[model samples]
Target: MEPKPATPLLNKETPIIQSKPNKKDFLNHLEAYLAKRDGVDKLLKISRYAAKIVLTSSALPETLTLTHRLMSFESSVGVSRKAFRLGKFVQDVNALRSSHFDSTEDVFLSIVAYGGEGVYFFVEQFVWLVKSGLIDKKHARRLGLMSAWAEFVGYLGSVSLKMRDLNRIKEEEKRVKMSIEVAITRGIKCEEEKERLGKLIEKKLMKRFSVVQDLADALMAVADIRDGKGHFLGPLSVSIAGLLSALISTHKNWVSC
Candidate 1:
C-alpha cells in the first residue's frame, strides 16, 4: 500500500472583527430612545433643568439675551414634557389594579399615590394648554396650584410606600445574610444559594436607588407646592433640585431603555 498522505495542516481560526457602530446604528438607538415616552420626557426634563441652571447663574449683562432665550427654551421644553405625561399616571393606576400588596397600608398608599398622580396628570394637560395659549392664561395659576398639590400628595404616598418597602427589604437581607453565615460556618457548600442571595441583594440595592430617586422627586414636588418662595427653595435652589431629579429620572430611563 502507498504511504498515507500527510494530513494537511489546518488553517488558524480567523479573528472576528467587530465593525464599529455606524451612523445607522446610532440612528436606530436614537429612534428607540425617542419612541419611549418616559425616555423622551426624561431627556426634555434634563434639558429644561440644565437650561434653568444656566439661566440662574450670575452672568454679564451682555449675556442677558442669551439667558432669556434659555429661559424660553426651558419653559417650552417643560410644556412639551407635560404633553408626554398626558396619560402617564394611567400606568400607576394600572399598576394599582394589577398588583397584590402585602398589607392594607400598602393598598391604601398605592391608591392614594396612583389616584393623586392620575389627577395631577389630568390637570397638567389643562395647565399645558394654558401655557401654550390654547386656553385662557387666567386658568394657569389655578391649574398650576391644583397640579402641584396633587403631585405633592402623590409624592407623599410614594415616599411612604418606598420607605416601607425598603424596611422590608432590609429585614429580608438580614435574614439572608444570617442564613449565608450559618451555611459558611457549617462548612456547607451552598454556592447556588449564596449566588441567589447575592442576586437578591443586588436587586434590593437597586430598589434603594429608586428610593433616592423618589426622595429627590419629592423634594422637587415640595418646591412646586411652595411655589419656590422659601429661602431654602429659591429659584436657584429649585433649579438645582430639578436638575438632580431630572438626572435621576434620565438615568432610570436610560437603564430601562
Candidate 2:
C-alpha cells in the first residue's frame, strides 16, 4: 500500500491551453452573424440616407450632376444590372465618406459642418462661383473649404434610391435648418458684432467681386430664412462664408496651442 501511494503523480502539473481563433475565421463568423441580424442591409440603408442628405443639403452642381447620372443609369439598366451598379455606387459614396472623414479628422464634425444647411449653402455657392469662373478655387482650396465641400458633394451624389431614404432626407433637412440658425446666432451676436462682420466682409470678400450687395444681402438674408424647404441657398452661402472666414481668422491662433 505504501509503495502504491508513492507511485501517485503528486509533482505533475497540467497546463491549461486556450483555443486561439484565427482572425479570418472570426471575421467570417462575425459577417455571418451580421447577415443573420440584417445588419449589413441596415447599415447600407443608413449609408444611403446619409449620402442623400449630404447631397441634397449641399446642393452642389457637381453632386446634382452625379445624382442625375446615377438616376439615368438606374433607369437605363435592368433590375439585376442596377443592383450591381448600386453596389458600386454605394462603394464610391463610402469612399467619399472616408475621404471627407480624413479631411475633417472627425466624423461628427464632417457630418455636421459639411452636411449642415449653412455649410452646404456656402459650398454650393462656392462651387457655382468656381464653375462660373467668378471666384478662384486656389484660395478656397487653401482654406480647406473646397476639400470639405468636395467630399460632401461626392458622398451625397452616390446615394441610392429608396423610399425610406427620402423620408430620412426630410428629417435631415429639419436638423440642418435648426443647426444653421443656432450656429449663425452663436457665431454672430449683437449689432456691434454684426456690423463688424459686415465691415470685414466688405473689406476682405467684397473687394474681390462686383456683386457686393448680392453677397451682403445674402449674408443678412440667412437671419430671416428659417426653413430648409425654402430656396435659401443663395443667401445661406454668403452667411456661411462670412461665419467660416470670421471663425478661421479669429481662431487661427489656436493651432499653436
Q: Which lDDT values do the candidates have, in the order given?
A: 0.74, 0.38
Q: Give one digit per residue, the lDDT tens place, for model 1 in 1-257.
A: 99765432211331212223235566677788789888888888889988877777665353568867877798889889888877777787788799788889888998888888888888988887887799999988788889988888887888788788778878876776666556655667656655655666665776777777767776777777787777667767777777787777776665555
lDDT at position 99, candidate 2: 52
Q: How far off is model 1, as Cα RMSD?
A: 12.0
Stretches of candidate 2 off by over 4 Å are: 1-26, 62-64, 70-257
Highest lDDT among the candidates is held by which one? 1
In candidate 1, position 202 carries an lDDT of 62
Worst 10 residues of 1 by lDDT: 8-17
Could you tally the backbone clashes for each prediction? Answer: 0, 0
Tell me the tens digit of each residue's lDDT in model 2 across 1-257: 45433222212241112223245565665555455323333333334433444444556566457877644443333122213222233433443366533333345443443354234434445444454457786654432354344434433332211122344445554554444345444553334333433344333332233133223323333423432235544434534443443333223222111
RMSD of 2: 26.7
